[model samples]
Target: MGNTTEVTFFILAAYGDHGQIKYLYFSCLLLLYITICLANIILISLIYVDRSLHEPMYVFLCSLFMNELHGSTTFFSVLLLHILADTHEIAIAYCNVQSFFLHAYGTTEMYNLAVMAYDRYLSICHPLHYSSRMNSCKMYSLIVFTWSFAFFKFVIPMSLRLQLPLCGNIIDKLYCANYALVRLSCQNISLNNILGVFSLVLSVAVPLIPILFSYVNIVRICYKSPKEAQVKALNTCTPQVISLLYFSVSGFFEMVETQFDLTYVPQLIRNVCMVYLFACPQILNPVMYGVRLTKIRNAFKKRFFPNSTE
Candidate 1:
């Protein structure tokens, strides 16, 4: 039995113990990380330099890339450190910081996705008024609100965690999450659990409702248009929708997993989900928008190799 005053650290099981497998895993993750960084940076740069790419849709894409960059940065960089060190032990203060930033970025990404959905909603459902409604002031406000809400959602939980006395520090996950922190508490975790559930509902579920409804309505509207127009519209959003669904559902599952006995499930499932959350969106977002948008592709080509034109 561990004493309340004793601080224990968690031992994260690496992806694989086999030397060859570990090497392969590290190599793969490194490549993926590099790809994510380069892709997002180029996309952001293209949006910034090209005046023609300046539209509501591309603006939202820029925001999405920014959010994804930050979100993946928060999680994956820490993950890289863990992979190199071959340990997951974090000091209590560091853990708190990690939790704060992790939740902050995660929440920000969720809100950004909601913004994207709203942009799509306006574009497809109310095309005539999209420009008028989602104007410069409104866009600025939306960006501000997304960041503010993310900060709001994270502040209390982070503060509460700071106040709580940690009896043990055996966090199972690679990074600090609500479940991992709550489990470390020597006091009643009921309040923490309540807040956790509430945040998940608000941050994940609430926005998702509108996003799903928006997409459904978008599909309906698209069906009324010509096939090419419908395909184009669907192409614009399909990646975002896929990303939203994967991240939201996987995130919810990870949250729920914390409530159950960790021993019951295979750690592999958790690891796979964690990797999926980080890897999928970062890999797909650029392709979804950059490849599909001719303007962005041409801009990228022009920017990278100023002499390339066929």
Candidate 2:
């Protein structure tokens, strides 16, 4: 209503204010970042180099690891910056870039999980056709589609945000999320909110529906098989299912926080959920897929320390 002055910068809330706690937080997050990078890198490398590990499942695992690396890097790197500077003033341009990457990676991760679920669906439901159905060309196409879909889903809302005039330069969360940014706009943001909800529904909720249905069918198929085979199937899928569940639920909670009141309790819970979303999957994924696989473990031992026989 006043002058149409555009806000140029936004302030972020630090997760913690106490100097000692902040220090502890930095130290802990740094350690986690290091672990996530190293573990995912090693897992991806092992899958790449080991001929025996070349399969549809391992390919999806590699993609997931890559997504995890990028996703965590986007958020945690900014957190590190905030901690070091002890301030939350971010330029509007930088905020847009951050928002773009965050949504891109988040959406990509969602699609990748969907791809992984479909792969499992093929493997369990149509065992004989799994190989031919998920061939290199098909896999590559799916990967491309995942990235493209994510890009469009994120870019559309981001483009809409660019048109709005920001009134205040203060974002409550540590990251430059779309809803968070939209709330600061002085213009009518009903369109942005509508698009945001639509994107969430399509990119997050829709993919999860198929994943759940696929898993249910997988479980049903496994139930009729021999106990040993069923156990093996469950073991192979348990990690991905658990990872998918955690990502989905935590993601929904974070989205809900954006729409509702942000009290201290919800904020604290959201922060904890964020750690689970960012840290836990990246940390556990490699261990579940690579380290637990005998072929990869043997390859690691053979390549790193040849003479030592375990």
Candidate 3:
């Protein structure tokens, strides 16, 4: 083999079996991908088309659903292709592309949730100032920052990997990840590890702190407010809290799997966990918002069933 530059492809070692079980796996994943796309698209359309739903909260929800769709497509599309084909190899350049988008999606999503938490905090804790504080300019600024911050976080690590000669090209996972790719580098990866940790904090902890803080203030305010105010705040805040918990738990599992060896876990169980970690959030997020948020539900019903009273 020529110097590390000659390597052109990588073997993804975590593909499902080549036997009969592959079809069952393929069928399940295909259904999941379709549902995720349809659900997110419908939500985005509803928000865009309905003038009444065009507020800060719904705008944020639309962006959140779009991010979910982007992330899911990056993972599930590549995965479905490999499942259908006999070979599970990916070109180096495209692998980097996938890593970039998936990482960005994860970070952006966390930031979106944090922004939602902030919005909720203002609406409930400081209703008098909510309208002025969350103007169009501020909303655009938050959305832009979430995308830009997440984009650059992965770019540095990816550029670093590109310069270093890879020692091997075998990635033992379903999809490409910055950490996984860096692990295959031939040179010392201290810098990469440091930056990876930095990215993790930026992606997960940065958004998480705001969510926790906002909720803390919200809880305090609700406690001191009247019974009616308490009920209203609780209904409004429940969806965001649920979304936060779901993402947190799933992100935790992903971190553990990446940092530690899980060889002892049964292969089937591990596979299920891996698939669910990514798929569940994309599928459930829209459902959580759609069913729980009365404004969205009533709007959806009205738009789809204009004539029916029930």
Candidate 4:
């Protein structure tokens, strides 16, 4: 980051081409991508087609699944291409686009989870006013707010990164990351550093406050309620709490990979860690919800296998 160089394109040196092994990696990623697509698509279909799922919470879930599909495609498609290609170069403009969407993908997911927690809180803590409070208008507003706010929050970082003069053109990972690009800057990056911390608060940490508050209230209410009520709360909240924790762990891996020194670790392990940051959530969320949530499972059956008795 000392010498100035105007980098037009970036080489993704992290992609290891071990000849035949590339094919194996390609196949595995292809299979994983297909699974991610199918699982999320099925979840989205069930939510949209089943009138019983027209509620605000399910609608939020549909949005979350749609975002999963978008994120998976953005990641897997380019990765599959690079795995098969002879060169691992990405044009600067395209890299910027990918960086923006990928970052936005992560931030949007946290926001979606935050809103889902609020919906769950409203459902468990104030059932009598849930309908009025989480009306169609307000629900849609929250959904829109999540997406818009995420994209808006990430734009500042992307814009700051664009103005930087890169001292290097090689990204150490399979994908272009905003912070990685910032690390390549030849100039003083104190502003980017300051903004990075500020954006982390706005994009990641701030949303968690509300989500935690919502869950705490739910827990307090369930503690004082009947045994059946506690069971109902767990039944409704289990998938989301698991999803939130899963994503948090994945995000932690990402934060460590970017912020810490991982050069000593084997490349395969690092790559696996990076892949888990996004892929695990996409695959696990839908599968967990599909299998564990009776309403979703029954609705899926009623929609696809009508011969089965409900």
Backbone clashes under 3 angstroms, per model: 0, 0, 0, 0
What RMSD, rounded to one decimal, does every model reach?
2.5, 2.0, 1.9, 1.1
Model 3 worst lDDT window (10 residues): 1-10
Ranking by TM-score: 4, 3, 2, 1
Rank all candidate structures by their lDDT, best first, as comma-separated numbers: 4, 3, 2, 1
lDDT (Cα, tens digit) per residue for candidate 3, span 1-310: 2245456988888885678778887998999999999999999999999999989999999989999998999998788888877888999888988989988988998999999999999999889999999999999899889888889878887888778777688887888877888777777889888988888888888888999999999999999999999998998889888888888887787788778888787766766777776788889989988998899989999999888786
Residue ranges of candidate 2 with Cα displaced over 4 Å? 1-5, 266-270, 305-310
Identify the runs in model 4 with alpha carbons over 4 angstroms from their true place: none
TM-score of 3: 0.96
Query: Which numbered prediction scores highest in TM-score against the true structure?
Result: 4
The C-alpha local distance difference test score for the whole of candidate 3 amounts to 0.87
Candidate 1 has its poorest 10 consecutive residues by lDDT at: 9-18
Q: Which lDDT values do the candidates have, in the order given? A: 0.76, 0.81, 0.87, 0.89
Model 1, total clashes = 0
Q: How far is candidate 4 from the true structure (C-alpha RMSD, Å)?
A: 1.1
Which digits, one per residue and each the tens of the lDDT, describe model 2 over residues 1-310?
4345568888887355656677787898899999999999988898889887788778887888998898889888788878767567888888888788888877888888889988989988899998899999999898889888888777778888888876777776777887888777777888888888898888878888878888999999998999998987787778778777777777777777778776766566667776776677778777776655667778788767799987
TM-score against native, each model: 0.89, 0.92, 0.96, 0.97
User: Model 3 misses residue 280 by how many Å?
Assistant: 0.8
Model 1 agreement with the true structure over 1-310: per-residue lDDT tens digits: 2356555454454343445566666788888888998889888888988898888778778877887787778778777777656555666666667677778777777878888888898988898998899998998888888878887887887677667776766667767776677777788877887888788787878887778888888999998999998988887788778778777776767666667766666777777777777777777878777777767878888878889875
Native-to-model Cα distance after best TM-score fit, residue 85 in candidate 3, in Å: 1.9
lDDT of 1: 0.76
